[model samples]
Target: MKQREKKELDTSVQGIIIREMISHVTSEHMIGQKIKNGELRKKLVEPVWNVPDGFLLTEIKMEQFEMEWLEPESCTSDRVLLQLHGGGYVGAMRNAYRNFAVVYSELGHGMPVLSIDYRVAPENPYPAALEDAVCAYRWLLQKGYSGSQILVAGDSAGGGLVMALTMYLRDHHEELPAGLIAMSPWTDLTSSGESYQTNFEKDPLFGKTKDSLIYNREYVGLEDPKNPYISPLFGDFTDFPPMLIQVGSYEMLLSDSVEVAKKAKSQGVKVRLHVYEGMFHVFQMAMKLMPESRQAWKEAGRFISLFKDET
Candidate 1:
């Protein structure tokens, strides 16, 4: 095996470490309240959500969940990538997700991407989001796309949902996806990972070890935090499709990805984990300006392409 070089912070990524993601910290209590009251939508839409030069975005309605389609002119209609945007189970699908979806499409040489706008917490919680995700997949299948032609991708909570949704399908003996691409996935909603404490200072998005309690409580409502559906880190990953997991070195949820990767590997799943040094959570949203983010998007597209013909 070739020796992997130690990754340093890309200059572009380093420049925005504080300005783009880190410096923009909000109080945990207020953020949670905003989520509960449904007032954080505008605040969560970052200005960085610009569609790239060659991609086209069209809003489409689904039977259960509405989605925005991001497609490049070169993209094929048969192979589709379904995405779930992250919001800690409360935040809605923001513009940043649309931008990233386009980038993912471009990277895959124009593979169409369906960015699902699933329901959120404090209103429609837990199984609600999961149900919407499953419904979206079912709608896709109903549209004549086989399970092997669809790849599931999500960031943060969406990433956890990617795994949870797949596990749910497996348990129900439903068709599985071609593969999975999870970026900085929040697999452990319980906030029990060691990186939650160790990387707390280095992470810019999540402030402290216990900062996610309110977000967790609001989403998990009346359910065990460690329940496999809520916290996929504890779920059975055996016989899961191939997985591509990317996480930043400075993220508080780094261990969440690491633990999931370990468990999935132990269960004989083909898993690849890439830790971008000095990067923060869900850094792919910076694909427009950050080289590493672009590279991460490329990696995800490549992973998705690997299974386009396994059927």
Candidate 2:
């Protein structure tokens, strides 16, 4: 029955189906079994090569910032989407998220996308990741970009980073962005969501396994896991810009996404939440294989298109 469903999903959203299956079989089950395992990181760091039109693709390195850029070809000036890739906070890189950026860059609004290569945990923890995200955003501002033309985006851990970054900037009185996008963000390191328990085995992508939880513990260390920066769902959302959050119905972080959106709404922040039925985490990348993923990507592209005139 699982194989039949996999085959059906493969016909629609192949990239997600293949990766999720591999992650479940290889990284998912093996997560907590061993003391030292780089398998999850290895699998998550796979290269992404697809590039879109209307942009120049390149890499940049500064003393304080290092990242890959996707600049639209026809637009002499454009807004920026500062993206952070997710891999349980210890894995994955900006390159791994290139395809998602491409979808937004060309298909969405032809805006430039700059995906940051933030430091991972164990080697660099807590504020290190937050600092990197801030530094990258500052770099763009220094390059003459306006806050009103910028958008912060991420998936899973990166999604959490975007929310934290917004809070940090607010606390520092820095100018806020025009908008934000969080795709199945892991807003809670504490994994207190009911969905975390309910969707454990039902979801093929991830669950509250002992091993993955260990990685979360290492990332949070002694800090209160519910700290707004660690879990932005707990933060003050006043004056936040218009935002969009997409979540998978089957994901453990489903509640996190919903709570964040609900909280944002209560604070009067314009928030749009799209709960994709039968989806797992970060399902947009699998558009190459799955129709659902393709539809999700198209939806993202459409949402981003609304901002093209803002820049």
Candidate 3:
């Protein structure tokens, strides 16, 4: 971790971070190579980390990736939240993203969610993840949902992928989702942001030299890291969808979200960016007892609702 500026924190949030989370979600288990993809994935999707009640969870095999569905009993069967789980481009998505998937299902006015388990780094590298996501979108269309009925969303690297996938779709003249949700998105794989070093120690999730050097290389392989598909901060947002960008002020990727929102807004895309004070990377996942997390979800729900009438 790098040095960070002093932060003023919400007392309750501090307590939750120190008491409830620190024990298990250490840096080693998060951004480091020590991450146990299989074990940690299961732990995240545990029933204990659920959303509003009366939701059903099921795993399904998709055309290009495995996926888990989180459907509320009263969900809009035709509308879907297509989710990409973040793991620095190297994490498992199925069990890992299930908790947040359920939350999105409840908050998007009971919109069903399909969280894709895309191929990750070191093995499937580069365009593999994006390819799988694109396949998932096509699968949704095959099921009869129009483009306007879908919302593309992701957290961390998945958030970056949301931008990449949406751009790829538009470039290829494929149907586009109504909007996008990026939670602490890692838009800059180049690690060029000041916040990368500035917010390091303040962030409980990552390590600078190690994670940046290793995982980024693993994901990029021989590709140029600055390429938009790899580092979306460098991408143009001319035809981007309505976007809601959420980030923790304390996370190193804060600049990544800020820059993305700024660029998208400048391009006349509807953009809403919410920076939570003293929060960590993808803090939205801590919806269990965090008021801010709930508030973020509420904001996301509202954004998701904006496209409801179109569907």
The top-ranked prediction according to lDDT is 1
> Could you give candidate 3's per-residue lDDT for residues 104-165 as a string of tens digits?
77677678898888988778889999999998889899988889888999988899999999
Task: Indicate the worst ten consecutive residues by lDDT in candidate 3.
Answer: 33-42
- Clashes per candidate, residues 3 or more apart or on different chains: 1, 13, 0
TM-score of 3: 0.85
lDDT of 1 by residue, 201-257 (tens): 656666453434223578888888898988999999998999999998878889999
lDDT of 1 at 287: 70
Candidate 2 displacement at residue 305 in angstroms: 2.0
**Clashing residue pairs found in predicted model 3:** none
Which lDDT tens digits does candidate 2 get at residues 1-311? 69647554544345455646745564434453331233446455355665654557888885654789887777544677889887767774845488777766666456778888887776777877889999998888998888988888898889999999999999999989888899999888877878878877655555545455323566676788888888888889999988889987777789889988998999999998988776777787666576677777777777776676642
In model 3, the number of clashes is 0
lDDT of 3: 0.77
- Residue 284, model 3: lDDT of 72
Which is the better candidate, 2 or 3, if ranked by lDDT? Answer: 3
Determine which window of 10 residues in candidate 2 has minimal summed lDDT.
Answer: 28-37
